[model samples]
Target chain A: MRPDFGLLLINLGINNTVYVKTDPREIALLEGLAKDDRQAIETIYKQHYNMVQTLIINNNGSADDARDVFQEAMIVLYEKARSGTFELNCLLKTYIYSVCRRLWLKRLQQQQKFVSDIENVSETVPVEDELEAHGQRNTEFQMMEKAMQHIGEPCRSLLEAFYIQKRNMLDIAGHFGYTNADNAKNQKYKCLMRLKKLFFAAYKNNTP
Target chain B: MEEMQLLDAVERYLNNEMPADEKAFFEQLRKTNPEVDQLVVEHSMFLQQMDRFSDWKQYKATLHDVHSELLETGSIQEKAPRATVVQLWKKYQRVVAVAASIAGITALTISAIAYYFAPKPASEIQLLSRELANIKRTQTITDKKINALTGQASTRFIPPADPKSGGTGFLIDGKGYLVTSAHIVANADSVYIQNTKGDYFKVSTLYVNKQTDIAVLKIVDNRYQPIKNLPYALQKNLADLGEDVFTMGFPRTSTEIVYNKGYLSAKTGYNGDTTTYQLAISANPGNSGGPIFNHSGEVIGILSGKQTTAEGVVFSSRTRNIFTALHEIRKDSTNEDRIKLLLPSSIKGLDRIQQIKKIEDCMFMVIRY
Candidate 1:
């Protein structure tokens, strides 16, 4: 959850919050991401959300644009950290800022808007592999999300319960009202195969 | 049939359920079959996307709570303008009223949908079982048709039902004798065994026990040396459930020797077969004939197929059965001196890594041409 600033949401849009330096505590906090702790990431977002907002808003973007880019950058970091592919070469805040700046630049370029502060973004050289991995992940996530919408129910929920919630076969059986875990197991396989089919088909159509 | 096995293997590999050797084989497949590779990526992404969606909802809920607290405490550094507050309230009220009415309808619709789906959970198992049977029948018919047209090359394409399984095997005695799964070389006219050194030797199947599905082969190449006093021996006793064990195999057709360790998870094989014990290792098809060894390097069982119904459940034929089969093979007077009757393992009590190091040379791959 975002920390409440009371009526001070106005200050969130302001550019004066001093950037935080990476500390030992922050290292521990980033490590929490690898452990799949959401609270750590949310705290990271809470701290850096304002910096991202100021960057985007100052550079010909909207508050919504800042929010989206900031969120995407956080996801990028989250995935990298979780995969153990990231190294703390620089401060965590610096790393996230670079990602947001790069994303903002990409957006500006997509709309054919000239980016004035492109030099500032180029300073950190945001981890290339991380950026690419995150890009691929985002693309996959979006495609899969779209495919999920087209899928029929029960199968959808079954996938969510098993894959998303990481529930066991028996528990899933009980929740989904199957006769037995084995029965649910077979049904789950069919659902997964079908989901893969539908997802791949949609991905193909969408890609080119 | 080969295509089906490939798909199954790909699925398991994508799930990270394959042991090291089998995983290497799957990596090779990804290099060769771009379609399979793409399928893996798509399936993984699909699963990940679902997880991301779940997390997103949780995250948004937390964010909403934070937003409410900020509003309640008015701790925001600067108050939002009075005019902006009024305008926001006006906009919010409209949204809230619309959202309230939609949510009411949505709740009713959800309950109706839930009720419709709740009662009917029938025939899924029966349907899948039948579907599997149908696939088997179709595969057999296709194989028979291909057999009929073997002499003449035709436009029709028929895949082999029993696909090539590059399974594992280990030398039981130091005299070029090896034990592998019967199914690995079953119904095959020509079979070759290879080792980690890339040396391919002719495998003469001396005994094929179909009931227990264990095969004993003698490596016949004169150039191949009978490995000296072996460092490992087959266990005369059964492996207790939850005993620490490890195995090695040429899972990727001898690309690299691979080792995996897990505990014996069950006293009997799938469906409670007494001749085999179920291990918790993620053994794959290519690891079918690998040896399951105790921490002291005693060969306890033969590494076999994984149960498709669950993850991390592997079944291995008992070493005792392999010994029993060897005993039966040695009973003939003419064969008495030809094949060694009793092959006992001499190595024991070594650490895990050292045991693996010594036992790796005894491992072989049963490859079908």
Candidate 2:
């Protein structure tokens, strides 16, 4: 049997989920991405890969370049969702394109690889703060990555299930094969404590 | 503030469960107290980091699918061309050149696959008997050890050890006596015991029993001592075949302790060897000599080795084997101080997770060079 790649975990308590329109669907996609849902992410890739590809290719890049930009944008979106701070202020598709645009432009500038065409386009000029904030976010996110890889499970998995996946207390309890639900909660706290110790210790010690 | 309370407050603050007044108070504290401020930032970063990890895992999976899809179906029909066709025509030449190169790369890839599949001799296949659990994977963790101003605190990505050899061991006493599989240290020129906290201590072999395959070691440094009370009692009731059993060990050299669960699947060892029990737990290469604990946190067996062809059927030397060896060493008048260190565990009635917490600190990864 094929594994179901996504679990549609909606924190939206009210409003029955019958309407599979844009917002709820995006929320589901974001949540699915948080859950690391394969199909949801593939749908996203299929939807946006070409958009990013066309932009990069038109601006003197290749299909491979497009793939990288799209993947990178997906990572940024995934980071936003994983942070549990994602609110559907804009459509997911629109946000992805803008992010890809920013990323591609930044890369092109860094490498000084491309010429014009992306410049005169009336897309919202990304501000200094926005660029700086994105840079800061990327650096901090990278630091977090280093510290987390050093952490082993079930501490690692517990934290992921809670903060990233937003899985409820009981389901996490079952997943880790804990003796009971209460133990799972306590263990989650313990794991969090350990994570804080690991993360901050590495944070203070990390020069970058 | 107290450390535990500080941790508790950090949790409450992050979970947003603090009362309105408390939230205001904590925010005030965050301004005045640097520790609380650091804690708050660290907590948020931890959440983001954990989420990033989850995303990367799923993201990698989708990326893999896309790579395959692109390879097979050739770019999924280009998504209806949002850009103007005139601009696209102007851009198509450069893209065409890139596409030609990509096609050349694909041809090279197909040839590479053909070369990779070219088969050779049956003599290349030999059943490997040496069950060494060295960290085999190429480690991406660049920094070997994390150094604080005060001391060495973090050892990242299982520091460099002989890629050929490694094994597991557990602290039998607070004064630094450890019990591991004989095969781990029996052939080692130099041995280092790395704790879960990433502290490495040199260890000298105190004893190694060849037949039973149990070895003991004493930590070289005098300052280091583990938990005073051994986390598990040495309870050797091997009567029941189906008992809750678990092991904590470094199954691979590069990672920290891994915990696996299963039942005592059989009475005899491999090929009906009497000194061991057939545990249903999947004992990997590096798990040799790890303490096998029952649900009550009793040391029922010392995990030895697993058969090559079987899955989840590993052998663990019964606690009785260790006891018999200890008795013989006493009779032969081995150093009196050597026997003094081994102690019965004081912990009991703890469930699985609790047992793990207590026992995890007591286990160490033996990095042999």
Candidate 3:
């Protein structure tokens, strides 16, 4: 029975020549990644970080540079997977390698350093569309970050406590020294409006 | 004020915190007023951005944490040091070669002088036997001298000047069986345990397992009284990481039992040994065989040793090893008495002071001669 099942698997592998099938393990990891699971992200980072680190370090990049490029690629993959449009045309390893390569290449060119042919250590996948979407998302995220920086004082901390830390109003009230939750909630609303205005200003400036 | 109220309502509606009737009314208002509908749409988009922004920040934090952890564990390598180290080695080659020869000549000269002055033995086998006999004879003479000085008939005993080794141990069975580190009592002519009150009792080694570094002792002296119950139970299960733990031991320098508290840092010991746990507590020499207790007052592990080069990198033999050792002890039917482990610790709910008061009596200073 085991040999018969093995033969069936071989036939199935032979028949599925046109389309590259995704590994069930990779699918499970990507699904976990979408939910921002720390273990899944850690596993992926442990598995693929060395490959990306080696690629970058071999091409006139330092370990810190390798870390930055790899992390940016991770963000791209994370956002794409979370957006629910990531289709596995290639293995996750190959895709991450390609993304890291493209990201490092762009970084090197931007710095106007002397360029040479980068060694392709793995199979390549065309992730230009995915990268473009990530770029737009990154711009918006940066705008939000800038707005948060300029939001200032207790307001910034207040908004962070509510939105980022996801603390409830009562806890925020006690932590921020508000007499009641209603006062904290009101302060949070005012802070949110100011943050929205600042974010939009950066958004409009970037578009034009 | 009016705009704040509207914004609050819109946020509540977006978060699905609105009541059924109020939500229905809000939906009708959205249909009738294009301005309110636009506000709802805009707020929803902003809320989505906020959600993603939080996630992005959190994911970045996780990546940073994982990177640092992996680096600490040596799972990943940094590239900058390697290139720089190679260049530095090349530049210092001549200087290193010159220093190496000078050091080598100095070491050889020192060894030559030492070898010239060293005593020669008649034969290797005879010398080994003679040295062993000499050590035993000297130890016996010292023991006799100390006993004469202290007067052996007294209930209180003074510690000898030179002991073979010393460590802490605790009672495992109320029937006078105590557990201690095997290294403490592994090779000894006599073993004695002194309580905090300075009362001493002679004990004989019952079983010693060098593999787990655990030894069992039974008090044979008539001066010892068997307690009816032990306050703390030996924990059978593995303890969780980051649980608060405290230990009491007689560090060699201190006469009194020193109490120290720390937490379990890792589930495994040095080099991932499953039978031990890595703790973040600082331990000194003579702290071996001390009981590591959790906050709830159960004996979780036996304090074993510490990494010499690092601070607070202590390792403890897990309490379950005692169980495994006892299983082996039970299999040997020649052992007449049964070693019953204490269960249902009485000190479970007590505060630290009360718990220590009840437990301090069971802790003993093991001195080997």
Candidate 4:
């Protein structure tokens, strides 16, 4: 008897996707853009550009302005991905919206316009204040960046390979001469700790 | 199965690495054990964090390369022979002098125009008149009966005998380290905390944000009973537009915590400041410093401010700030944990709620009054 292809496809699809409802393939495509893949970037842009455009338009920006802001946001994402600094802490859509939102808000303020467009917007998360506070701590980001630079070569390389190179666990393991993927992961964790130690040391010294 | 093994299997399953037999076992486990199911969800979040970190590194590398290239090109030109520089300098001198004269003339004309068009400085009497008119307008608007009613209700929330009106805060560590608006608690006779169970404890020794409006308060009594199995919300990075979020705090009435639900309106940048993203949400005066949660009840931001005129334009300090603040308070904490906690919150559908509830259950709760 033949196996049910429909069931197989569903099962395969569910297993590969992070969230059951969202298209996992889209996420993969977005993830691939980290490798400087223009095709993947274009795919992501086509899929979610409307949402980003809407975000800007809703936030008191014109369509033309939205287009410019969206492009700028994409460029920033592209740069971050190329530099290995773009962390996928949120969904691609969310991250894109955030980038656009920040850009649009900045544009409005630079134009010296009252931010009445955002007047009715309701925030569910308290991210705004947090981002502001983080912005104010210029010393912390600078210190953290400096510490990251000072970390030992092996640790830095492992971190860069795993994070910046967008290498899979198995690939990272092979590149780093680890016994297996698990070992590579564990090594990454350890290296992360070392980075944190350096960061703390720098932060502490800078503090009065 | 043991928790570690269970977590590992869940991680494998999330990564699509589970063999048929293990996948079957995991699916079975999910049905029988909600705790294990929750563990899987939490572990998946860690995976998401890893993915994000990886992507961030990739982007950072690209930026670094661009900067290096720019520097190299600039340096090469700077190092060119002196002979070429002298020839170019001579050739450009006449053009440069003409251009400078034209620029100078344009600047003078623009400055003169600006001076001619500029409004005269207002006299003291004029300034006073304007101030009085603004005050009258404010009074007229606030005189509405609804405004009076709301004002009275707000006043009622504050105890007459107690000098300090309650503010917002969060629990750091197992200790009752709470943060709130400095303006709220700057003048207080006493500070107290009320847990989810309605138990109250006194607090003392507070820390304030360096420049912003946040203040931190530590529980005074060493023996004070901290809330057990508290639901500590993970402070994720931030919320995206259309992501569902909920805020819990005392609004006008201090008798009970008010829960308001809304989507992230906008990721805002204040006054051309590109460094931070501000969120517009629905918040009130009493909600300052209250935890803002995603639909899964993960604390994404701290409700800090609301638009002075409007009802929905609430502002928050990002979870990143809290992480940095916590780092400053305790240097021993790992950045991994901080990064994990500060990972941004995103919208997930209702089908994912079961997965999210498990994570929410692990959150530690801090109650303050």
Best by DockQ: 3
Tens-digit lDDT string for candidate 3 (B119-147): 76567679899899999999999999989
Report lDDT per candidate.
0.74, 0.73, 0.88, 0.59
Candidate 1, what DockQ? 0.08
DockQ each candidate and list the results: 0.08, 0.13, 0.32, 0.04
Provide TM-scores for the models.
0.37, 0.37, 0.47, 0.30
TM-score of chain A of 3: 0.86
**Model 2's lDDT to the true fold?**
0.73
Q: Which parts of model 3 have CA positions greater than 4 angstroms off?
A: A1-19, A114-116, B81-369
Off by over 4 Å in 4: A1-208, B1-160, B187-189, B236-238, B272-280, B331-369
Candidate 3, pairs of clashing residues: none
Report RMSD (Å) for each prediction in the order shown: 43.3, 40.0, 33.9, 44.6
Highest-lDDT candidate: 3
Model 1, residue B280: C-alpha shift (Å): 99
Query: What lDDT is obtained when candidate 1 is compared to the true structure?
Result: 0.74
Q: In model 1, where do residues sit more than 4 Å from their true spots?
A: A1-22, A112-115, A118-129, A202-208, B1-369
Q: In model 2, which regions exceed 4 Å deviation?
A: A1-208, B1-163, B332-336, B341-345
lDDT by residue for model 4 over B1-369, one digit each (tens)? 254455556667987988899789889989899888877775565445445455544544553453345346552111222355665788799999999999999999999999998867667679889999999998888789778788776522221333346555655444456656666666566666654444455666345564455565676655465444334456455567777777666655343555576766667534522223355566666777776677665666767676666655666666566666665655544422221232333333443445344333222223333
Tens digit per residue, CA lDDT, model 4, A1-208: 8779898998887556243233566456646666666556556555556665566554546556755676656655554454454445456675666666766776788999868545323222213543454334435546555656787778888877765565687988888788999887777767766765676576568641
Candidate 1, position A92, lDDT: 77
Per-residue C-alpha lDDT of model 1 across residues B1-369, encoded as one tens digit per residue? 455456557657867889999899788878898998887786666656667766655554554454345436653222222355665677699888999999999999999999888855577778889999999999999999988888575542322334365688888777888899888888877677777876677778888987777998887777688876678877887777789988887766444888889999989998989988988886666888888888777888887688788989888889888878877887866674355533455557667777778787888878865
Worst window of 10 by summed lDDT in candidate 3 chain B: B78-87
